[model samples]
Target: MCTYLKNMEGYKLKDLKLKEFDSIQEMFDRAFKRQKVKDDKETTELKQLMKIILDEEEVEIDVIPLAVKSPSIIGWKIRKEGRKSYYQIIRADGKSQTYMIFSHMLKSFDREDLENLYELVKAKYESTRPVEDLDLILWGDLKTMFEPHIEDKVWKNQQDYKVLNWKLYDSCGVHSLRMQHVQIYMLVEKKYPLTPSTLTMMLEKKLMIDYESEMAYQLLKFIMK
Candidate 1:
């Protein structure tokens, strides 16, 4: 090698064929710029998702989601020792609300496709999410029970309606109302340690019944006050 070639230096040109060193620098600059653009896009999309999931009003005795930003979570669940576990839950009140999510009701994302992505940033707690998202559907799954209650006499009326087979299965804002052939309590009872979607499938398979006052009243009367 010539003495001039050995001594000439700025950035290393060994990777480039010496003549293409300038081209290599330009390529590096463009690649870094593209990466920045992708990051900005992800941040914006993620923020929009949070707005829908994190901002929701809690329904009475319902496991509804609270407000949360990305890298935040406030799901409802029960603990093994029959106690509530407290966490910094983002609420619709535009402030941080603390809720003791029952550990029993916490659902882990089990999809193999998303499992690898989740493993990227696993937390000590199973129910915790890395960020908060928005919930566009305000009513969510509990919408069916919010309907009017009807019966032979005045089941629709709150005064005449009796708490028959009702039972508080899990402490994650879930309850079961019993009536006639349909029983909705089991639906909530089995949701512990699983996602709501999982329990929904159990109902679809005819393993669960709809909201029925008969069983709810009977169960509540026998088991709880």
Candidate 2:
């Protein structure tokens, strides 16, 4: 097992004082109880979809509603006595439905595994792109632009510099750098509506990377521009 997972083995939801609802509706009700506007049709439909997916997958999950500005539901699944945790989110806008299972646990990954994962994420991102946007700048574009300026060969020596950046930044925070990357891309393209929480979900489950040591700070700097 991964060291991170091992460290989390003793943790439990109840230990955090998190109350799990028996059904998704109950969870939503609790989440929106204080709000003047209740859960809308889009949010309801998305919750139903999440329930179906969980049932079909036979996943044992604890449905927890988030108390954020946007209406969303999160399903948490624990396996092997908290040795593994999976988080799945469904948003009202329907653009951010995805599962973040084990990919967040990157401490156990070797260089080759990280490379393969990076390639997989790149291919998936490319496949989802619009035909007209195929040539647009990507994580690789940023990496290529910055590689020659980097003095340390350790960053360049990796099979894919993008993966190296992801490793370093993910180690810093769960999805900090990737979220900033998405924010920058959205700023540059003037598209893709994003919020801090939704962008984090996309990074963990959908949106997928750059650099060596300074990438996260560089991403922050880019956003400041």
Candidate 3:
């Protein structure tokens, strides 16, 4: 039993006697049944949606270039917390926008697969030769979210990357009604340790700094009311 427990990654079976094994087995059996039912339901729903889309009279299928049709994995960042590891892959839409996919508890990656992905991004970057002509935008990291601001202000002011745009996303400007407000609320909720009221105050100040005082006040009054 000691050897068996030691073989486990971080779990201990010493406290779990043979009597508890039956209960654990039963619980896993029930969970498996529940998952199968849920998967079947989702499969049926997807089939129905696919049928409807295929049978629609006015539905159109416009062919796009192969390059534009596929999502490109440009870069990645790896993070480790204790024994768990996470992989955040940066994906570009072959257009101007980029987003991140945060993977949970990734077990491992094939060396050849990673090499291929790196080469793909490198090729894309090289295609736009004469480096000075290439333009790119990288989003801020959630970990060191604001340290760049202090560094930029103190020493790199002249070379600082200007706030080309803000409010959730640069491309999502103006077209998304009330989305910027929702984004601010979500950002505060996810990234900051603040209550709703405090977040509102912080957002108001941030907007004011961006010369959006009127919008800031309106948001505060509306949300607080």
Candidate lDDT (C-alpha), each: 0.33, 0.32, 0.32
Least accurate 10 contiguous residues by lDDT in model 2: 48-57
lDDT of 2 at 178: 37
What's the TM-score of each model vs. the native?
A: 0.21, 0.20, 0.19
| Tens-digit lDDT string for candidate 1 (149-217) | 334132333332333343343223245443444333233323223224333333332212223333333
Q: Which ten residues in a row have the lowest lDDT in candidate 1?
A: 132-141
lDDT of 2 by residue, 147-205 (tens): 22333333233322122111232332223223222312121212222334443443334
By lDDT, the better pick of 1 and 3 is 1
Give the local distance difference test score of model 3: 0.32
What is the Å distance of residue 130 in model 3 from its true position? 9.2
* CA deviation > 4 Å runs, candidate 3: 1-70, 74-130, 133-149, 154-166, 169-202, 205-225
Considering TM-score, where higher is better, how would the candidates rank from best to worst?
1, 2, 3
Tell me the spans in candidate 2 whose CA falls farther than 4 Å from its real position: 1-100, 110-112, 118-213
Displacement of residue 116 (Cα, Å) in model 2 is: 0.8
User: Could you tell me the lDDT of residue 102 within candidate 3?
Assistant: 15
Which runs of model 1 end up more than 4 angstroms from their true locations? 1-15, 52-225
Question: Candidate 2 clashing pairs?
Answer: none
Candidate whose lDDT is highest? 1
* Number of colliding residue pairs in model 2: 0
lDDT of 2: 0.32
